[model samples]
Target: MTVGRVGKEILEEADFNKFRQALIEELVRKISRGGCYGADIRQIIEETLREEEFVNFANKLAKIIEKRTNISKESSNEAACQLVEEEIADDIKGILHGQLEERKGKSKKEKEIDFMGRESKLWDETTKRFIGKKHGLKDIALILKEHRLMKITIVTGFILLIISAFLFNSIYKAIVVGLTLTIFSGDSLRIKLANVLGGLGGILIFFTSISILLQYALLEERRSMELKEMARDYLEKAKRKENFN
Candidate 1:
């Protein structure tokens, strides 16, 4: 199935209205960043029109000119406000300025910036626990024991599992690493570290899985037995596990 997008709906026309909408979109971006409300955007648009067109019109042009599909009326206001702020026409006199749709999708650098915000939102959305949803002690304990129910320990345990996978050369270890990271992406580290760790943990899981499976397959039974015996031979190395980074 193809994913649908907005903003492109206005592309049917290649006129002044289109330029206004494009200008509005840029304005919207700036206003959004500053947390400016629609009123602020409208005020800016009004000032721009009054100065350039020699008229003080409200510029309700977005709502009037286009159907509000992906664009909100408030968003239109923001977009118009943003248009004037960026110096599109420099003077907005008789000269015409046209802004094309940059792309159907956000540029990769824009997407990267957007991704960090989304990743932040993911953390922010997880902040509070719902008390009523909390079950009894027995239920909680049983939930903790299940492989599928790793909502909490996965954070630190994921890192540990990564380290553990290298030591064991087992697919089980890699699966455990992935499962742990997924369960606790919202948690696990300071918010900043959590973002880095969450992404890294995902990468670690995939590569570690392949590394583990191949390492296991390559080792013959006799070699495996010898490795285990050799591991057991050293007391100091007993507790510390090797890393798979």
Candidate 2:
């Protein structure tokens, strides 16, 4: 799609609000799940809002709420105006209750630390629950391990591309090879980019790769059409020859 059309669609306020509402509803549903904890809720919110569309909607909604509620932009205590907290108060309470119940068998000190960890900040408290001290490190390791194969593939592909470019002594050929590799490796690129640069950046890379692939597809399509026309001409000539015979 053209930039102008994308801009127009993104700027539509009604659509933006609709997306925001949908996002809010999804968060509520996730939070209300049985055995759901504050950490899970935070994860849900972070992953959902990571999308460019959702992020844009959130920023717009926050500004609108600030204006409507007369909350000063300079005020640091605007968490109360947050869409999730405002719209899903009961659901949040339920989630908190579930979390509390889950911790029933733990020692008082453990429970206190967990509560204090979450109470440090509203959103932070909700997501920063006690999953054990080593949980944080394990989470990081798991994330890296998940993308280990993709990283290896990307490195191997680039090395091969570089070697081929050197052997052929043609930068143009290398570029075409690189684009082809990128087009086919779109999923790996998206996941890596999102993990490294966040959701919006990943999306940008994904679309850029798709655009390049589309160009390649268009070129092939044109070539196919030309070949079909040529075959049609050859068949016509052969038919005329047969009739003449």
The lDDT leader among the candidates is 2
lDDT tens readout by residue for model 1, 205-245 = 55544544454334333333433333233322322432322
Candidate 2 lDDT, 195-236, residue by residue in tens: 323222334334544554564445445433443344344445
Clashing pairs in 2: 118-125
For candidate 1, list the clashing residue pairs, or say none: 24-79, 24-80, 27-82, 27-83, 28-78, 28-79
Report the lDDT of model 1 for residue 99. 12
TM-score for each of the candidates: 0.19, 0.25
lDDT of model 1, residue 38:
13
Candidate 2 deviant stretches above 4 angstroms: 1-17, 24-47, 74-81, 91-245
Candidate 1 local distance difference test against the native = 0.35
Cα RMSD for candidates in order: 25.7, 25.1
With candidate 2 superimposed using the best TM-score fit, by how many Å does residue 148's alpha carbon deviate from the native? 43
Per-candidate local distance difference test? 0.35, 0.40
